[model samples]
Target: LHAYAQVVGAMPRAFAEAHPKWWHVSLKVTDHGLTTDPMPLLDGGTASIVMDLAGGTISVRTAGETTATIPMTDGLSARVVGERLSAALGELGLAGDIDTDRFANDDERPFDAGAAASFWDVARLVASTFEEHLSGLSGDVGIVQLWPHGFDLSFEWFGTRVETHEENGETTDHPAQLNLGFYPGGQAYFYSNPWPFDADALLGVALPHGAQWHTEGWEGSILRYEELAGDPDGPAKLAEYARAVFEAASPTLMA
Candidate 1:
């Protein structure tokens, strides 16, 4: 998906606001691969991008049958994939100066079928749990997206504005938000981060089953997948952990 990230990131920056929550809201797992929610093209038409790890290709399809593909060769590094994808996009008239370095690295792990299948299972479970929690909340929620940078599937929920910053000479508001996602990092886990607050406040607060408050390099909380793999109530525990952290942090973060 690092290649697909390059495609979307290369699309006109003008489309950024239209996808502020940048993760594809309707992304789903088809028998073939992971697909993006339909996106509006600069030409005023719609297209959906698909990342088919199974077929080793990134596909572009119009609302109709017209489709284009960029291959993901078995031995190519991620940077090479992005470059090839960019050239392909240019040939197809999709111009994006594609940023080749958003969470860029040169790891040489060849694709693994077993690992992919297992990771997809965890990703689906996490997405479902997030859907369950978001349905009960009235605050603004973001699309549950899989970002290529961190290779993490995440989304955000917004609350009252807490601060603002100037970016590229434009002012942007920063709201209190709870970001939730599944990441198959060095270890697979469910990660939750509520912005604008310190981890110290919840020092003694009990986490859901199999969770811990981590503050090594950042202030987010985590629950290991290794711990939940055997739990009969894994789904419930994940949702409960999300709720516990959100409820514990929302008020003060919003203030």
Candidate 2:
């Protein structure tokens, strides 16, 4: 799934309008799976890449009603699949550079249709929960998206505060923000990390559902997925955790 996402992400990165926040490259959750939305083609048409997790295939479709599909089969290497996608785009007249380095794995991958379907179910639920949380917030909020780089689902709420950074003799100002994300990787977990994190103000604050302030490798609050699994009130508990982090850290972020 991660490999497929990387290839899908490369489409927008290579052809879509470059969003300053790179929102264009992030995949949006669809009813069946994830989509790259639409990328305008040089020929005045548009193209999109769709990962049909439910059907276990990656499809490339063009506005001209052309489509090419690559099956998600066991033992297909990421490189092979990427090559197929690139070739498909070429055949569709929307050829462009697909960063092969981003998915430079030659090892065969096992595809479990049942597991993929289950993941899609969980992704839909989590995306809905994230959106519900975002609706109550006032200010600039990003849409829930899945980042292919880390294969994490997340969104950000921007604060009024501006943070300044200097790099290579250039100075830039960026808005402070808080991210609520779910990482489905090893030991899956959810996190709410505030930019320019104020350790003094945020640490020691209580978080619900066994969530804790993690300051070891990174700074933020995290709640393991296991904490909510099988619980009847899992969604509610996740919401509470998100709200607690916001209430605890928003003040410092705005300050």
Candidate 3:
């Protein structure tokens, strides 16, 4: 709800004074320290400004359908961001349209115009599918497959290429991702590259079941693995953290 709050708090009295009769604002906060439905603040007419910091997004909406969405990062503080937002609005000329009924007539620093809350409920909804989106390239030659193992693990296969099997013990043929396979596994598996055995040095050969490797990063490095495994929650945790960062950077918009 931080986004809505920023817009509400920074709203220019001229805007509120212009539409005081029909326009309003409100906010809905949850226990998880997230905000949603910032429009409610305006609809309720109780508060002119509302902030929604949920689902990895910061959004502020006015009765005129004018909205400000900002991406969030964990490294930044809310107060500093608020000040920056106020200045940005002033520059954009939107600040003058902010509702003023709920704000003091002489409020100069828009950041301190009203109260704020964490919109946790809204956060949960957006963070739901983050873990499912862990797919990317590892290196030029090898194939990187992400599995939900003990930890987030990626297996890179050089030489021949990696393969998969079905329940009937028959090998299945599928196009390799970028000439490599990028399979998304569980959290633990993704966190730590875990497999049945060590498959390094065995290029073009698919090791037996439960064999994978974990990748730390890419620095022109080439390491092979026969098999590997790790913590399960790794991928989910990483996804959640990333979503949180994105949410802080900006607000969500309905395209």
Candidate 4:
């Protein structure tokens, strides 16, 4: 799944309009799986790549009704699949520098259909919860998206406050923000990190559902997915965790 995501991510990075925040490079969750936004074709119309986790396939479809599919099966390297996709795009008249090196893993991993479907279920739920949280906030909020690079689902909310940083004799101002993300890799977990984190003020605040303020390696608050696995109130607990972090950090983030 990770390999496929990387390959699919290359489409937008190579063809879509660049976003300052790199939003153009991420994939959005579809009812069936992850997908790239419609990218303009050289001749006319648009094209998109869809990774259908449930169906266990990656498909490239053009507005002209042309389609090519790559099965998500074991033993296929990312490079091989990427070449197939690149060929498909070429046949459709879309040509650009697709960085094949981004997904150069030759090691093949088994693709479990059931596991993939289960992951989609969890991702869909997380995206919904994140959207709900973002909707209630009064600020510049980003769309809930899946970053193909890290394969994490997340969104950001920019606060009114401006934080300045000096580097190489140059000063730049950036908006204070909060990020809520769910990382499905290696012991899946949810995280909320505030920019320009006020450690003195936030460390003492309590988090619900066994969530903790992590200062080692990276600073942020995290809640393990295992903690909510069988809990009936998991969604509510997730929302509460987000609210806790926002309430505690928003004051320090505001102008």
lDDT of each: 0.67, 0.88, 0.31, 0.89
**Over the stretch 1-113, how does candidate 3's per-residue lDDT look in tens digits?**
23334344334223333332122122222332323222223234321233333334344444564355555433234454455455544544444343333322323332221
Per-residue CA lDDT of model 4 for 139-194, tens digit only, reads 79999999998999999999999988999999999999999999999999999999
Worst 10 residues of 1 by lDDT: 8-17
After superposition on all C-alphas, the RMSD of every candidate to the true structure, in Å, is: 3.8, 1.4, 19.4, 1.4
lDDT of 2 by residue, 33-76 (tens): 79886877667888888888888988887866647888886558
- lDDT digits (tens) for residues 1-255 of candidate 1: 443444444433322224455443334555546676665656777666666765666677677754667665464566655566555445545664445554254654366656655666667777778888888777788766666556677778887856788989999887888888887777778888878756668756788776878778877788888888877788888889889988887776665
Better of 1 and 4 by lDDT: 4
Give the Cα error of residue 15 in candidate 2, in Å: 1.2
Q: If the candidates were sorted by their TM-score against the true structure, best first, what order would they fall in?
A: 2, 4, 1, 3
TM-score winner, 3 or 4: 4
Off by over 4 Å in 4: 64-66
TM-score of 2: 0.96
> For model 4, what is the alpha-carbon lDDT of residue 196?
79
